[model samples]
Target chain A: MKKLSETKEKRSNLSKRIWADRQLYFMLIPFLLFYVIFVYKPMWGLQVAFKDYNIFKGMSGSPWVGFENFKTIFGNPYFFRILRNTLLISTYSLIFSFPMPIILALLLNEVRIRKFKSLVQTCTYLPYFISTVVVAGMVTSFLAPSTGMVNLILAKLGFEKIYFLSKPEYFRTIFITQGIWQNAGYSSIVYIAALGGIDMELYDAAMVDGCGRWKQTLHVTLPGLLPTIVTLFIISVGNILNVGYEKIILLYQPATYETADVISTYVYRLGVEQANYGVSTAMGLFNSVVGFVFVYAANKISNKINGMGLW
Target chain B: MTMRTRGEKIFGIFNAILLTAIAMVCIYPFIYILAVSLSDAKSVNMGAVWLLPKGINLNSYSQIVHKEGIWTAYLNSFFYMFMGTAVSMALTTLGAYALSKKRLVGHRFLNLFVVFTMWFNAGMIPMYLNFKNMGMLDNRWAIIFGFAINTYNFVILRTYFANVPQALEEAAKIDGASDFKVLLKIYLPLAVPSLATVALFYAVERWNSYFWPMILLKSDSKIPLQVVLKKMVVDMSSRMDSLNYGRDMTGTSEDGFIYSTMVIAMIPMLILYPFIQRYFVKGVMVGSVKG
Candidate 1:
């Protein structure tokens, strides 16, 4: 009887607390409903990837054909090409674009002139705010054969004006260069902040030890930046497959598709443009699973190396 | 300051020169586009318009102002930016405020519920189908309500809210203020800078949005400025000879029209960039510290 009374009292207390926070709970309803409908509902809709979806019969009435779409995608040679393109572009980004911001930050940090540093930062960061469409558009125009500035410069230098966009060989270079130009400065903000946080005492200690600027950077500054770099590198590894398909879709042509097309763009072409729903969803599911595994594995490795992995 | 060594002086001069060169390279594209847009068709075709306008003309600008779809798309973009940001702010603010309170029921679970969406999502087709199922296809609500809350922005706001003093809330509560009243009377005022940062993030996102609007909206009339600009600037790039615009107009050219449209599309962002710049460092710093 005493235990039952204690349980009832606890239950009443919970109810009373809930009642007191009713308005707060009410405030969360719209956001929760949004998540339920838009976010969680899509997870449920991943079932269509497994099922042979019939548009007329809707998502529920679709027949299950476990892994058929996956098998079909794997059987195609084009799928392998897409996968290669995705990996190549991602790896190129990692190798080239990843180190840019760090280099930029280090370079900028060594500048004693505040005005020059700020001006450089402001100019470099401006491109990041420009729409992807505009950037791709500018890229297209700048590489145009006849009237393009690049071609004009080449002609002035006595080299033949080449159509850069149509050449598959030039696509990856253009893409990677454009990525660096657009993002490097904006991305340097984090590293700049990290640089600011390095202890001044340590720098003074290094100075007393007869260190030059370059030696101080090598010993003290680099060590201070190591944690931030490791964390960012891990995050970049996790995002290896997500190569901004929006820009690719904007920039790439049919001629350059061999080198430029990535998995997401292919999924878009199949699912939205052609209305091949089931196969496309399966492809998308594959992409998501691979991305998730990469993130999970990277997180696990980071945790093993240092106890600072994202939980 | 210590006396500078000769090597240090040389390095500083070289660094200054290199940084100046980089800044010039960065700004050159915008200048080229602007110059090309303003130059005469004849000069542009002659490839003489480099770095500066030759035979300057405002015909392209005039044509854009008078164009049928351009103004409509511009208005549509502004509408989306304002309306989308408003809805997003409401959802994010309410959600952040609720979750920031440690005493809230299911606090840990609710926080997890939101943050989990950040790490994983069902990808494009599933999301597209969900929109199709919800009757959001070709709808403005697909653009607005479809992406009402970004997890990063939500996390930023929540972190800001979590750092607010508990004593202020208690004091408000003692004065018989309700939860909503306390939030409005106390928290909202203090969180303006953070709120502005998130709002600008959403607004700029809505403004620059191309992919979803291109995919979701089927009708030409419903498309945003970015889509319209894409059709003009990018689509026309491959088929330059097929461009039929400005043939009758004296000073206008195919590239000029395209470049002008890009400039107009870029104008709003360039105007708002200073304000956006101020908040970016602060917002990113705060977000990195807690989120």
Candidate 2:
């Protein structure tokens, strides 16, 4: 008799639990509607890469092109050049820009005074908030190779003024170093947060072992922030193909296109400026695929090594 | 006891100097621009105004304010940011809540679907053409809907919701509260900081956005501030013919006002960032810890 009563009561409770969450479920409806309409439905249009699309005829009426656009992109004379520039610039940025934030965070962590630390942080992040156009414009004006401040200083110091923007050799260096200056401080915030969250007990233990500040930072702080570092690294890999069209467009001209013109800027020129939709779409699709692959590979490796990744 | 010897002392000072120098390198150039913008045109052109304004003035700022499309661009950017943030926040919160529930129907499938898009996009041209077909191309709504649910933000939000103590919901249930009531009464209040952070994240992303806006916002009338900023950077007189964009007081080219326009584009975010800074890092990146 007791068992029977308990079973009946449990069943009633289960039903109540299931039915009680209706409004919560109701709130989720619009988001589901949004994804279905925008993301999912549009995924069907990926077929356009294979089709000879016409603005007037539209997707349904367009003739099947079947790898023609892809073929043309591959056959294009400048495909290799653009691809190389994209890879080189991304690689340069990755090498220089990736590690500066971690190091900045470490340096910031050592400062005992709160006000000074914050001032350092504030000063660093200010550059990031400045518009990319202005950053590029500043870069242009500063690197004018003669009258610009850099050259002015160079001339004072008895060095020849190197034309930073117009020279292909100097373009990647200027882009990467300036990229570091603009973003390293802002990016350090993530690592700083991670560092801040590390258990104080770990540092205490390290100190008990006679570990120096450098040793504690190397052993404790670095490892504690490892997960954040890994995740950000993977996300950045996914973004490698996104070579910031606005700044690049502003910085590049016919003279520097040899090294500076990347896939994003190239697509903007051909697609938006020239209005050739098909080839630019092919180029964009190409960028997405490569980015997707890099992200996937990085995540997989990170998962294998640390059991932490974007996946 | 002597571990912190003379070498250690030197290292510490060296580290401090390097970092402080780096900090100045990051900051001083922009300050130079600010100085130049406020300086008299003669001093600015001659590079005398690198650190300080030659003649203190507010003319440059007023000149940009008086530009034709500048105000419209500001309004357009706000419309996209405000409306876009509202829709994005609503969807992300609800989607997160739904998925956070362990007993919810089809939760696994939904999670998988969201994550799949993160790894593989449907590519840009398709996204653009799709927006075109849905009568949304060239629409701010198109921009709004294009990035409605970022998987990263979705996961962060879910982490926040999932961390909400289950007992709170259970007690609310015992009180005859619906799931909606529990979410509203309990979760929303607790999740305010996270919501503010993520909302700021969405706002920043929407504000800083340019590429898709470049594709979708074909209409000149609907251009966002970032797009206009881009045009100005590319060409000084992109929106203004050089004739029309001249300085108000001195009657020279609007070089004085260029920095002013860029500054105007930046002000809204700057004003909004500090208020949310307290919660920004923790609230948003808490989702990152789920990895």
Candidate 3:
């Protein structure tokens, strides 16, 4: 009876606190309402992955198919191909595109000319703002057989013109190179800012120790950037399976699908193009689960190693 | 200041030269595109237009202005950018402000809820289905309200709001100012630069976004500039494809037309590049520090 009264008193205290904060709660109403509709509602709709979702039948009216959709996806041979493609593209991107910004930042940081530095930054950063459509279009035009700049250069060099876009072997290189071109400068902003935060005294001390500029960079600047690099790296690891399909969809053609067809693009083709909602949702759910696992593992490893976590 | 060694001087010169080459490479594609677009069709076809225009003409540009649905697509894009940014800023500000307060009810859970959406989402199929179910397919409101707040921007704004001097809030409370009034009169005024950063982020996203609009909006009348540009530049044949574009500019060539369209689409962004360049570094810094 005494314990029950103590619990009652705590409940009343919480109620009083909530009443005092009613105004703050009122301010959050619209945000919460929209959040539920836009975010949580879709999360709720994940149930369709289990159901044999028919567009006309609606989500609720659709018949439940248990794990049949999941079975179908696993049973299909194409799923494995897409999975392999997804992993390869993301791994290639991680290997090739990840270090570009850091390299650019380090290169830019070594320059003492303010005007030259800003001009380079401005030129490089311009591509990040260009739409994916435009970028993909530019890629196509630049790789065109006869009139394209690349082919023209090849001809001038006395080499036979190659249709770079149609070749499966060339797809990953083109995609990775385009990713670097579009993003390297903009991604360097974080590193540039981090570079700015390093103390002048460290460089001075390094200089006093007879360290040259390169040595000072290797010792002082690199160590200073370690935390930022680690954090960004962990984030990228979590996103290893989440290759964006927008650019891939824009760039890929039938001839190049052998190398270019990732899981997200396959899901896109199934759901939007074919109207196969049930199987597509199951694949999507699978992707999300894998993505969540990657994030959880990355966070766990990060916490164990450095006492830092995404949470 | 100590005098630089010869080695240091040489290294500096090499660095400058390398960086200049990189910058030139970065900007050269756009220059080439512009050159190709302005040159006559024969020169472009013969690969004669390399770094500069030959037989330069404004025919493609003038032709694009008269193209059907181009003006409508531009108007649609502008509308989306303005309305979408406004809604996003409002929602993000309110949500971030309330969540910023440690004393607020369910504060921890609310913050987690916002950030969790970043790590794991329902993916594309469910999202598209949800919009379709809500009769939002082909609707303009779908474009605006569908993606109201980006969580990264929310976190950045919330961090800025949380760092606002609590002493100012205490002073405002003593004046008997309500939470909403205090937010508008105090927090909003103090958070202009941060707000601009987030707003610009939303504006650029809204402008450049084509995926959802391509999927959700079916009607030609409602599609954005990027979609229209994609149709002409990427999918269509670009040789003698100018017959349907305009009558007087019949021989202007579709190759030239595609380049012109790309240039036109890029003009707005290039104009706003300076403004965007100013705030993104600060914005990125805040997020990185908090992380």
Candidate 4:
């Protein structure tokens, strides 16, 4: 009875303290309200994924049909194709585009002239800030079969013009290449900052041990950058399925859907364009669940391996 | 600097050449687009304009400027960018300031609540439906509020605010200043650099937003520049051959007109880029290191 009275006293003291800081709580109300209305409320709307939703019946009135939408999604023939395309594009990006920034950072580090290095960095980073709509426009104009610069060059060399954007086989290559072009320099900023953090004493020690420039880079520099590389790799793996669909939607046509259509775009088409809310939300929810699992697994693995992971 | 060996000298020279070539590859496409936009209709149609404009003309730019709906799109884009950034910065600053207080009740829970939104969201369709239900569809507020506060930017700003010395706030309090006064007089000035960085990020994001705006705003007059640019490019590319037959082939080809629209769309970013380049790099570094 005495312990219970002491606990009640502690609770009153805590409430008093909170009351004293009511101004701070007042300041936080708008932010909390924004999140509650904008972020959390929609999460409640995600329940439509499991329901047989009707436009007239609304969210609460819809009848629950558990797993039917998921079944239909799995049973559909286009599901695997889009799933394959999404994974293939993301994996290709991981394989091809991930290393380009590191390589560019390394190359930029080797530059002796400061002005030249900054110029190259600035020029390369410019494309990253350009709108995706403009980039898509440029891509189409540059690869246009009849009047594009690439086609013009090919004709000059006596080669037949290839319609690059329309061909399904070329979509992945174009997408990955554009990804590299747009992001390599911007992404390299992290590695460059990491490179600056490396101690100069290590380089001096390597030089004392008769290590050449290349040898010093190989032995000391790479080791110093290993942690950063590993951390970024884990994060990228977590986001492997969450590629931005805006650029793909802008660049793709009906002819290129065989390779270009990913889960996000497919969901957009079905849910928004066709008004098939239940199935699209089901697909979106599935994608998010898998993404959550991937992130969880990646974080756990990274923590176990290196004591570092995004929390 | 250490004395360079012969091999190091050779490597430096080779590196310079390679870096210059890479820079050219990065920049040449924009130059080509500019050239096509400025070239005569005949040269552009014949694909003769490569590295430079053969015949300079301003017809494409003039035509695009005089085009209906294009000006409204530009105006909408500017309004969205400025208004969205202002609201986002205010909300982010207030939230970060309040959450930065360690003694604030439920700070941890609030911070975690904000962070959770970063990893998980309601996805696109549900978000659209929610907005539709709120009567936000076909409204400019939909675009503005759709991306009101980027959780990543919020976290970074919160981290920045937390690092401000407690002595400053304590001094203000001892001087009979309230919490609001302390935030305005003490924290705001100290946090200017970080605030600028976050604002620049918000501005760029709002400027580049396409997906959310495309879904939310239905009216052509209210649509931003990107959606219109997309429609124009798609239409022009698909009907390229038809343009050569009977269209008034004057100073600019149909392709040149499309290129001009793209250039106009890109010019704002290109102009502001150099000014923001330093801050952008600093912002990214701060976010990555401390995030």
Top DockQ prediction, candidate number: 4
The two-chain DockQ for each candidate, comma-separated, is 0.55, 0.40, 0.51, 0.59
TM-score of each: 0.97, 0.88, 0.95, 0.96
Q: List the residue pairs that clash in candidate 1.
A: none
Tens digits of lDDT, candidate 4, A125-175: 988988888888888888877777787788789997777887899999999
Candidates 2 and 4, the one with greater lDDT: 4
**Fnat computed for model 1:** 0.63
Chain A TM-score of prediction number 3: 0.94
Estimate every model's Cα lDDT from 0 to 1: 0.88, 0.76, 0.87, 0.86
Share of native interface contacts recovered by each model: 0.63, 0.46, 0.63, 0.66
Position A114, candidate 3: lDDT = 94
After aligning candidate 4 to the native by TM-score, how far in Å is the CA of A69 from where it should be? 0.5
Q: For model 2, how does the per-residue alpha-carbon lDDT over B33-147 read when each residue is reduced to its tens digit?
A: 7777787776765556778888888888877778878788888888888989998998899889888988875668878877787777766556666777778867877787778
Cα lDDT tens digits, model 4, B1-291, are 567789988988988888888888888889999998898888887878888997899888888888888889989999999999998998888898899899987988988899888788989999999998898999998787767889878877888888888888888788899888888888889888888889888888888878888888899989998888888778755665344422333334677888888888888788879867878888887777534
Q: Tens digit of lDDT per residue, candidate 3, span B185-207?
A: 99999999999999988988998
Q: For every candidate structure, what is the RMSD over all alpha carbons to the true structure, in angstroms?
A: 2.5, 4.8, 3.2, 2.2
Position B106, candidate 4: lDDT:
90
The C-alpha stretches of model 3 lying farther than 4 A from their native spots are A1-9, A307-310, B237-252
Every prediction: chain A TM-score? 0.96, 0.85, 0.94, 0.98
Model 2 per-residue lDDT tens digits across residues A1-311: 99999999998877776565566567768877877777777667766767777889887898988889889889988889898999889878888889999999998898766887888887787676555666776786676543457866776798876666667888888888878888888888878988888999998899899888889889999899988887788778767877766677777777788999888788778766776667778778788788888878887887887787776
Descending-lDDT candidate ranking: 1, 3, 4, 2
Q: Which residue pairs overlap in candidate 3's backbone?
A: none
Q: Model 1, range B171-224, lDDT digits (tens) per residue? A: 999999999999998999999999999988888888998998988888767899
